[model samples]
Target: MAASLAAKVHYLDITGEIDVFEHASSLDGEARQANILLCPGVGFDVIPTDCLALALKQALPDATSLCLGFESHSLKSPGTAKTTVEGIGQGTKIRREATIRTEPMGVRARRIDFGQGERLAVAFPWGDVSTAYKTTGIPSITVYVAVTSSFRLAMLAANLLAPILRLPLVRRRMLASAGTAVGPDTEARREAPTYLWGEVRNESGEVRTARIRTANGYDVTIHGALAVLRHIMEMRDFDPGFTTPALLCGASLIEELPGSGKIKIR
Candidate 1:
């Protein structure tokens, strides 16, 4: 990205990694100086949720805290599975009072309804915790993923064995056990739709909730990335700095995508 900025070209990526996003954000000045955009997380990882965060913020402009949750039936690609292995011992990440904080795994869990019945969702180091803060300026942020009982048990085991799990050999073994398929098949992609939910609460106790349904993760990643690129190509003027998809194109970015459903509020 630095090279791209130095080359005076717009830099964009579909990364959902928090550390990478943070690093990109640190280059805001350089990006602006070069009149180029340093936008990342233009994928299922943050686009849907980040745009939802902005939507909730608009609905409750004074919201002080935000909670975002997602449930997806999409099968993990090899890359996604490898990412899971890499984070085997990492802690949960949240934004508190505009500051990023890391807490123990499984430290937070809640019931969230993603336009369906309630499900048990646990906090995870989702990229939105960082991007959404930038998009909405919400001080408190938490991102959760719905889990099955067996999956929850696996997380508990991973938490208790963090030290051992952190070993390179162990992570490698886990990765080896995970097959190297690229991702879901075309049929699976058609069958699997992802759901996202979010809530915002102000200091005055007012609250707003919204939900979105979109195509499978991989499909959304592909389309969302292209959509953002197209929008940038169509824009006559865009801010030249580290920015979220919503920040760059408003909350409508997600809705304007090929497979995103309407944002339902309650």
Candidate 2:
């Protein structure tokens, strides 16, 4: 039905342990922005002096901390499955393997200009799955992709990743640490006020930011795991080089609704 008809939900998959990246942003009144806070709901036993956010800085050198997540659901069923995600593919930087779900409708993204009530200039993809953790609480990561012309956000991501992905050396450098990254060393906490537009808020309470370098141009800001996830997912979904990521090359997750993804903390 979706193939023959217009699919309500579009799915974009990514591969290889994608790196966490970030960019700086300026918000406009209604252009669509997201806010993220640390999940007070989650806790880990290791309780290292450093938190997941700190680790991301070391692993994902070129990422900013942003709070926009994607929803991935089957075009057939838009009722279930949704997730609060960061980026895609064993996103070790943020400490999630497969932890979040996806939503049917694309996120209301930032407008090209702030005030006019224009539609989304960027279309972030929906996160597909959520990875669970055992000893260290429930850490996870979600992925998204924007392929179709209808999704403008996907296009912007492509623009950014271009220079980054253009050189094989950089891509190989990040992808080298696929599954075995421990995280970043403890560092002094920086106090930065998150600059945002729209409904975006910092759910985690403490606001932290970093300067990231990517295959494409890079920006530094206060968006954490979620925003980095979005950037990578969109890049693969829209780019020609990594059109079909390595992860989806073999098996794929079942079609579901938003928020359905889970990482059982048992």
Candidate 3:
């Protein structure tokens, strides 16, 4: 599938100086010591986060990882359910799952402890971890979202809708509707590709953000998952809070996937 896409995509190589800016932000020393949090979206979206975490562990051997599971707005609800970890032998291993509740920004998250050197996996919904950065003290966070081929349009809608969605009444109704609407079959109906956008912060108060899209076909989670790992691998220094995947990783990043084009800088 990847080989097929590699032949079709026309990607442009970003050249010259990549301008990265410094943002004034400080990482809590304690947060730097916290475990990694992986929020793969409900049901099908969960697969990509799991794949990304596994790929990340391979690239950063010393890193400990976990997948998030949620109670309030997940497909597998009301009881403990098992989820498969792809890319492993026979794909049979199951991570012990945990539940997270949906709440307003700045709300304290329930404490979750991890043993030394242990890689854990949990599943949770998007935006649920807004406060995890403070409560859990995680130094970095990578969020994956699937969007239509028209990524710019999707992103615009999200940005425009964010404030409206934040309204308590609206958020509650939306969550309620989504809980009843999404399911495992959701992936089958989704034809768009996946993208990864995340933030990395240092103790000295600098934040770097990145957005990368898959070079593979629509609905292919692994492509976006691998793109996330590549972004983490290539981000050695702080960048302009807004930047493209091509600017950071170069055109070769998409050389293997055909329909995938150069990163669009808006």
Candidate 4:
């Protein structure tokens, strides 16, 4: 499994600093040295952006300083996906108006260094777990999935399709069909309220798992963020690589969910 994941790790470099963020302030000496910024992926629904921002503000007032966002371009679409990279200081708004290009990984931005103590944040919307692990040297990372009966099946399918998607011919064929839309009401697109399936790992190592469901319509991504925040707040240590939330915080995170949310841990 480790070997398989290692195969997907692509190292690419960005040349000529493209102003990806609109209002990024120059980091002071202290902020550059010790603070950690949460760089979440694109697509709002897949990640609990607002909740995470709020949680970081309330919980780790000192360490947490910046939130990073990205603009994702579709393989088929002509225009770029405009995104805002919001910073905490002076409400700094760094916006990426045009798509930033990078080699090897196609449209996705490559691993960026934010000086010392920077973590490449991971969550549900961020699908490429191996890439994040390789890019960010941070040992413990949290990944969340919205687990429903169908979504679990989707994950199984994704696991199976992961390798197949790497095949040159198959990837080429799929990219050609990228813009083709499936019917919304199709079984594959069915909607259901989902609980969070959280996993923490490092490299190929699997640390722990947590399943959380909330009645207040909070998806697992929020808890995923909370789990990550709690993990950072506790100042716990673990093997450096990809890791799950439970591995860092244990079953207590599962117990902290609001109302009658179903909680399970392993």
Candidate 5:
């Protein structure tokens, strides 16, 4: 982002890193002065959920709490595996009253219906816990993903060994193994689909629920990045400085992706 600002070029990345967003936000003044856009999370990490959050907010302008969940059949890429390793031992994060807070990973669990049957979902430190609040003024936010029984058991074990997992040696070993992983094959990527779910509630108890199904993660990343690039190039005027995918391109951007199904809301 710094280099992009220096060169007076727009910057975009498919990162779910909270620090990256914070750093880019800190440069908002510089980016605005240079008339450059610094947009991030233009992919699977936050695009669908971010848009859903905003849509829910639009449905209930006084919304105060939000919950987002997803179920992805896509295999983890090498980069994603490494990023997971990097987050080892880090507890789950959620937004409370518009502030980021950390808690035990498996502490929160609920049933989520991702436009299909209900499944067990566990809270995690997903990117939207940070980005969603920025997209919508909804204060309380939690992001979750569908989990199998074994995965939930692993989360319990992770909570028990959190301190040990944070050790440099342990993390390095895990990272090494993650680096060796080969991601999904062409057929696997083509067949796998990603499902997203979101709900928002206001003080009056009104609720809005929505869901979206998209192509595999890697495909979404590729197409979303290009779509954002195209939108940026064809724009006459746009928000300068740090922004998010839905904020920059509108919530309809997700629906516009060639490989995504229309968002379903209730």
Candidate 6:
């Protein structure tokens, strides 16, 4: 449930193929505090790695910061990438050719008490955020997780483990992630053409995609799958066929994967 309606802006600080301006902001969190963040569609720019923190810092004023520190979080990448646990894990300082959004990364939001206050946040982000900071009043921000396999499993496990999992009494609360959904479930057929997303490191080391369904016979690649999946998922909250955040994934032209390409409709 949301209380206010304001189109927020996010600034990215990094070097990428292009500049992305499309975005969405949400006050997505539970219990104590109302957390807020700007979410972008898949195949879109997440916070740029280089200027993520500084840019975020500019977004926030002095009062809203709870706790800030350098952390390696997994939030950007979905599927198996969202299962990263928070800790002081050190990363090698290598010149990153790929952006932060390329991996399952995260940003950490410090805990702060906001009482029905409206404020913006900007900071150099560690990226992935876990739902721990709970505050009431005001639209506060905690953490937002993209819908992914690892994230989904972690969330599922945590939900079942509950307060007991948090307690030292049975401290073993780490969620076990299922490695990969390697096989296809043809029995679980879809009325429409479904999407299969993720990186494809093939003969060429660089990542490439393969989106296989297009009734109009357009190019459907990995990026295309995400675009389609995002549209369908977005439809659940807002009708892509007939609503805001319009479904532009061209679902009308997609029915099944093309015969030449391997499009898994699970």
Per residue, candidate 3 scores C-alpha lDDT tens digits across 1-266 of 12212343212121111011101012222122331212122122332222333333333333322323211122332111211111111111111122223322211122222211122222223331332222223433323222223532433344445566557776566555445543334454243343433333344544332233442222233354466455555555533222223333433444344334333221
Per-model root-mean-square deviation over C-alphas:
1.2, 21.4, 18.9, 17.3, 1.2, 20.9
Measured by TM-score, how close is model 5 to the native structure? 0.96
Q: Residue 117 of model 6: what lDDT?
A: 23
lDDT of each: 0.88, 0.23, 0.30, 0.30, 0.87, 0.24
Quote the lDDT for 45 in model 2.
7
Flag the better candidate by TM-score, 3 or 6.
Answer: 3
- Per-residue lDDT of 73-179 in model 1, one digit per residue for the tens? 77888888888888887888999989989887776888888877999899999999889888888899999999887777778778889999888888888998665
Which digits, one per residue and each the tens of the lDDT, describe model 6 over residues 3-122?
222322221121112112111212332211322222222221221111121223222322232222222111222222222322112211111222222211222212221111212221
- Mind sharing the TM-score for model 2? 0.22
Model 3 error, position 84 (Å): 20
Evaluated at residue 181, the lDDT of candidate 2 is 36
Task: Give the per-residue lDDT of model 2 (tens digit) for 206-243.
Answer: 33322211110001111222333344445444311111
Lowest summed lDDT window (length 10), candidate 3: 16-25
Candidate 2: lDDT over CA atoms?
0.23
What residue runs in model 5 are displaced by over 4 Å at the alpha carbon?
A: none
- Runs in model 6 with CA error above 4 Å? 1-23, 26-39, 43-160, 166-221, 225-246, 253-266
TM accuracy, model 1: 0.97
Tens-place lDDT per residue, model 4, 35-150, is 33222221222232222322332333332122222221112121111111010011111212122221211112223222212223222223222222223223332233222345
lDDT of 5 by residue, 7-62 (tens): 99999999998777767878989999999998888888778888888888887889
Worst 10 residues of 2 by lDDT: 40-49
- The TM-score measured for candidate 4 stands at 0.27
Question: Number of clashing residue pairs in every model?
Answer: 0, 47, 20, 17, 0, 41
lDDT of 5: 0.87
